[model samples]
Target: MVEKNTTKTYIKEWQKAIQKEISFLKKFGGTRYIVYNGRFISRDEMFTYYFDTSSSLPIPIGSKIRLEWGGLKTNGRVLSSEGKGMIVALEKSIGELISEATLLHDPWELLENLIERLDEIKKSKQKRARLKRLMDPTMEPKHPTTRIKSNVHELTLRSKYNPVTFVWGPPGTGKTYTLARVAANKYLQEKRILVLAHSNQAVDVLLAEISLFLKRKDKFCVGDVLRYGTNSGQSLANHTEITSEQLIESSNPKLSKERTALLVERRTIKQDLTRSFSKRDSDELLEIETKLARLLDKFRQKELELLKKAAIIGTTLAKAASDSAIYEKEFDLIIVDEASMAYVPQAAFAATLGKRVIICGDFKQLPPIAASRDLLVTEWLKEDIFHKTNVADSVNQQKLHPHMLLLKEQRRMHPDISAFTNQYIYKSLVADHEAVYTNRNKIVLQTPFSGHASILLDTSYTGHHSLSEKSSNSRYNLWQLLLSFQLIYESVLGGAKSIGYVTPYRIQSNLMNLLIEELLENENKNADIIAATVHRFQGSERDVMIFDTVDAEPQSRPGMLLVGKDSERLINVAITRTRGKFIHVSNTSFIKKNIFRGKTLRQLVDHQMQHNQQVTTQKIGYWIKNQHSKLAWSHARKQSKVFQDLQSAKNSIVIAIPEGKTLATEWERMLAKRHPKVSFTLVSKQPMQHLQPNQWMDENIAFPFILIDEEILWLGQPLEAVVDVDPPFVAARLHSRKVSEFFIGQLLKE
Candidate 1:
């Protein structure tokens, strides 16, 4: 056979290819064929009743024909040959079919059509067999572990090494509510279940939900399932309450105030750090930078240890049938909440804790640690593992594997919010079923609000904005982040009018402490809050949230940029918790630096007015300049539309930063001293508890000078950071000045 380029071949060429394949199959002995509504369907695919042992047949390969019967009409083609050299075909739908096929094939064309239809019938039979297996009664509602909801067609979400069935519901979608029902149903089937979550705050909510459904049974454990990432780990009950006292007890309770005092003393080191690198002061600057770095590192370790010691590590447990002592105390099934932000290895290991597992997480919220070299979602989906007999490579293959499902119906968030994410963010699992998902998930592009959520462009007012680089021993962006955090806090969360604040970065966490002190001294309002990484916020819901998608990467980075994967998970948690409103802030370039910055996100919705007008490069440029819009217009649709190219933006930003240059890719302190007043705010869910959130709320913070971030933009900073190495801190150009002013205010508060 001569082989040539077929890429540009029309559908008719594909038809001939099928005809040739069918002819070859005819030479061999063919199996009996079955007809469904006069259309060729395979006997193997014919269904008597659904069962665990049932199998499905394949559809016909390729031969175009239309069938009408039983008030149903469908366009189908001979897909392929099946069963002992017999040919078959499955119907390929082009558009929605509301009417049924009622007409019959003419008798004159009957035998001719029938013989040809044999192949089509054979393919249908194959497809039917597979569909039967999918609908197998035992595999459907009456399964050993699940309650079958007759009205819905279930798509089970699972993975090979990880047996967990993961589900994710947005805000107002009742993630906990759905979880409780699923857990209860599974538990009723005589399975020992473990319900785990990452956030200390989220643990509280889950425990409460379980308490309502089932009184704590000896066979069950639910609560703050502590995932001890540290080397020093321990075990405890699932729903153990953690308090400040526990932290003190974990360490020497006697050292409580002593540790706090040491942390306090480090604040004075800031003065020495502000100096520049000069021949006369270079030695002194180096000495001060070294001391500050050590102090910062030390404080972070001790503080984290304190938190780990306070959190509850699940029961003294192991899985069933495994008597390895460690695996001896086993759970029948395992369930993890707030899994999006979890490290892949930690989550995978946790999933294996039970004979069966269910994981619930939103990929859009956060992603796995890109730097961690471990088995993760993408890896698990792509790798092969031991089956009953052989290993299976793909989870989503034609043959059923008793694992893997995708839950696409999400109703917790306002349809708009969910739609935006599904459109501009993650798209793998969102469904299109009208019965299951009534709302069409329409989106209003470029809509920005102040109270709940909003998007803003580069807005500027009259001000002396300096782009300065911060001084640091390492080419990190700690200072830059610090300044940005303050500006965001005051402008968005609540200036002096608000009570709490949260920061995921350790450096910012430390700086927040310093700012709070000064505020309290000056008699500022104190609001308590939960602040940390997306991992910290996982499972825990909050009211009034703010997210900063601030990355220092230029226009060519991969994956998520300003927001770390774990941080993105946290940001997801933050946005979902806003019962009332949520706020999001990022460099005007965030979308450009991330996913929305690409061409794929842009769908051409042509100009509405007709003028026989054609859009040219020059016209497009004119359009962009006049509207200050980022996307191009297309000629397909009548209405003009803007595209959100998030993935492309992320890739571009990653590309802009040179590799191994920490300061270039990540935020730097010097940049923190640059801009002074570029800021924005968004709203989030209401607080779960009435008491104000965050300790920083009570700080007496203030500032006197206009701090600039331009101190280190062109310093001896590294260019591109290592792809897998820790990102150096990149300063928020505007925040340096704001943070400095806020620090002064905090100091004077007393």
Candidate 2:
């Protein structure tokens, strides 16, 4: 459950913040008003104004506007424009303003009051009936597991029945694809569905996939699909389907002239609707409402038809909340794609229009752009419904609700790269066998030197930050920049069609772009190389990915490395973007100190080092423990044979002990007593000599072994006494017979 505030302190601060914002906006206005058509509008502060059907200025509705009149400069947002006039909201703040739908204003009281109402409803008789219907245990998943994975089937089925079903879609697991499939399938069953995403681009992606799926199956015609909003035409321009814009174009032929006149009329249609709604004249309201309905019926029939046809409705969550046509409409199911990136209130508001809700996104990936950390009074603002509902404590304590699902099969990234993330992040992430056994996951790097698919280029630069003189947000390292160029050159020479360069800092990315631009200008050449920040390149991938970790200098500000999950998510996205090769460039010394940012790089370094021949005591101990169970039988047989030889020896067995060491322990004496013919010899380095007496023949040779009856040579770390120990205590595996024989031959020569 959520914590609620008992006092009005938070409410006051929230109100103060809003007032401060309005004050800040007022500062953007000047003391001048622009006159158009003998009418005056205040321009005292910067306000945005959009013209209606006029060829004055082609300022886009959403573009940031700065007004300059009478040597006074101010800024604001364009509220509305029509009939050779424009309505401008003075003193607009470009910064993220807390949307009215958000619960930041007295959230605690709102939530608490909501909970109290819910509790009262729970005690009512009608509530009991509703709960009984919802809690039907006989309800099972509708889809067959044979056709789809059980988990996915359960998710699709629960999402259809439950009011809200949260889906934990990790990276590369086809969150969009799965949801689209479900949407398409549900559509065929005559269920009206609305699919929403955080961005218009995300909506387009879902529409494209759903359209493709339905088309492939011959389930629905392409004309049944509809897209909405500004530039809806361009976004769906490639598709041979019906859209809202197309509907508007297809009007009654008898009124064609009237329609044309209406299109070019110097009046604003938006303002007409606003004025009509605001007026209290019943007859006028009826007339205006009837006209709007008729107009919308003529133009929005295809969109209306698509919604009725149960084909699919695609829109951004924000659009779904704001659009008058959809705000009042109810749907059988609402699927939210990339739900983790949407504000909780926005999604909740969208869910209100639907009977069932399905939220799909990975909380571990990039979330919504948080405007201000201070304004976000609760963590709920930053998380989607999926994350907020699935608390770790509830799951750990076995008190989890069973409606959620996780997509575990990662279809992207090489096994090497995916393996790191799987171990580092996922609870149970399985790499597809295709990525392991097939060549698809193998990265193709064409560097001059043969290196691993994932390679770390050590710049050796430490704690030096170079802030850009041109851009304030960027930082770059000369060493890293030079390395990036070399790698890019190599990649281009190696016949790579495209290469993506990503830097953690905007400054470094800017510097890299500048370098690329200058190089292109000088050489008069163009290449398919795109440089972007990690956040910008979220949904994109490249043939070869070159990531520049730009924070080689001491971090004065709390950077990606320090932020809890943001760093992990960013690094994961950066490294996994490469399809063929993942090239990481960073300073090792600087990165080792970071907990999250350089984790992938450090893992790669450790992996590379393991392949080298240099051995350590820990490495030796690990080897011995692993091989003990397999080679124990053979070693035991060898020991038995050595004991028999000592027992049967007629001559004394001369055993050499190293200097300053002894075999006078009880176990050693017992072994000596068992074999009375064995004798011990001390191998010592003589005074003023650099070599031991035993190694006088060869100064390069040193033996740390024990000889029994002068026949058996046990090659390992020698202890003070000869006693059998476990494998961990043993320093090395037994040496080869050839090496032992060569040593013995050298001893005889000495």
Candidate 3:
């Protein structure tokens, strides 16, 4: 019997999650759009609308939408989207009220379908029993009769009794490759398989692998493997043959011809109906409309037949539950890749569609993206199936689980590079593959990291602070930006080919992109380098990985990248993406002081300090002087220090403040009295009352900075009150005469 309490709880939690998502979507200004035009396509029984393409949230094809205009709202589904426009199939038409409407992304259909499926499972005894087994945390797994082997793939292929199997795949463990092999093995046995993942990209990847493996085995056939849902651009470019559209078009000529003929007939009927309506021929119009409806139904029936015939089908979890035809089908085995990123309800719904389920993912990586902070929403919606099943807990406690297999051999990173994650994050559960050791000597480093496998580029002594961006929550550090760019520049100069710059903020990534572009343009050099957040660099690797922890300063606590529950996983991913060397740039002292809950980052700093070469400001300064621009910059904590340094100025001092901000009266008076002979010029968006017209100029500045005697430059927000009151607010001081004079010339030119 299905437990009423459990069923109700599942429904309640899923509803709460849906509400949370809707609230988040509205709060973020992602759902509302101003419609430019709307028209009805009577033949296809759909409506097309055009709107601005600039949306904060991406609206992929096949997403459900709702149109609100003229005191009316109708639900619809996005049929196609191109530049600045989209076609949608709405439930009903609002006649002649298409002038200026609102479009909202409605995800309720998918969530409601999931909840209905859960309810269906609750009503079925067999499904309820299966769910109990899958979710039971206290159930002990059957022990293996033979000695465990090192190859997890072999073990998984040999097992046949478990109804639910979990694969603990860490980074570089060939998880997707293993899933493809298993699917291939099942196909050879003539068992139907359904492959699902949390994202469309993951689905495409696995389907491509399956197609390749089947072809290698000489068992491949047209329409044997199918990619469902909208085809991604990358997949189409790489493996178009696996898409359902391509397969159907290539294999079935009769259906293609019939579809074309039906489309032509429908168009003719639509044209005829328009004329019939103008002539007041109601009977003729009704007959033409009836013919169009029949044709559309026939077309849909043929398409559904082609979709359901594939022996191996692949799609995302959301699509699997949302598409009615797909959700109704049954398979012998359901394999979920990246299961740890799947929502609990979505994963559970997938589990009910097959006789046996195989889940592959690493809980150590990112989970489902949940924006709600409510405790229940997070507990139900954000948690993955691995955590719900107690599989992760079992592996963590004993390094092994009977029902789950852990892939321990890593083929991505060198031993030196992987050791950090192996010891601290994975608790020595992972080891390097034999090939890594055999080919370890083949890897070589460049100039800055010539003889080192890892280095800690500590910026604590530089007095550089990470400042919050005015427009967003993201932060950026000027010192780390220059330091990271220099490392990349010098590394490229020394023949480094592939590099990955992983940071925690978008603002820092954007700045790095600009700097890298400038470097590439000036030097006329090319390299395979990417600057992105760790989330974007999850499944990618490079020859050299530069991880910049952008959070520093005492006033700002550790960012979510360092102190959250997934901080360890974030760090693990960052350090393990390198094949040759790893460079961590940050203020170690600040991290050490602020990070209280997580030990992964703390242990990482200590490990690097103990085992690797340390790069200090002295070495960085020397490198900058010799290789790149010859400028020396230092950090100061207070604006008062800039005033003290002004005592030595002889010629001119320029203080530029941002709009609506002014120089502190006390600092202005002190600087004037202390440096009487120094020419002081204040640049502001408006004329200041405290200064003479000759001493003040009306000009806009992005941030507050001071230039002293055309030789020393102070870069930071000096005019803000927080700079003086907060100890962590830092400003950079550069003592390069040429660089200072360049700035002075630019300011004085206008």
Q: What C-alpha lDDT values do all the predictions have?
A: 0.33, 0.51, 0.70
Model 3 residue 126 distance off true place after TM-score fit, in angstroms:
2.4
Candidate 2: C-alpha RMSD to true structure equals: 23.4
Clashing pairs in 3: none
Residue range 548-603, candidate 1, lDDT tens digits: 33333322332232333333334445455432223443333323434442332111
Per residue, candidate 2 scores C-alpha lDDT tens digits across 1-750 of 433321122233333433433333344422223423211223445532322323233333333344443344444444433334344444643222211110011112222332333343334554333223222212343434455555546777767656556677666777777887888878877877888887777787778778778778877664456666543344465653545554445534544455455444324444453344222322232333345446655655545554555347787765665555665576878887877777554555555556777777776666665333445433645555555444322434434445556677776665655666676655344454375434533245354223345656654422133333232435555436645765676666555666788877766676567656644343224347888788777766676788777655434433543244566677777876766677777655555665344455455445434534222222322222122210121232234444454466444343444434344343243345444434543343422132112233222212334444344444332434223233333322222333334334444553
Worst 10 residues of 3 by lDDT: 276-285
lDDT per residue, candidate 3, 469-519, as tens digits? Answer: 655668777568767877777767766678889898888887777666644
TM-score of 2: 0.59
What's the lDDT of the predicted structure labeled candidate 2? 0.51
- Predicted structure with the largest TM-score when compared to the true one: 3
Candidate 3, residue 408: the lDDT equals 82
- For model 1 the TM-score comes to 0.39
Q: Where does the lowest 10-residue lDDT sum fall in candidate 1?
A: 601-610
Clash tally, candidates in order: 181, 17, 0
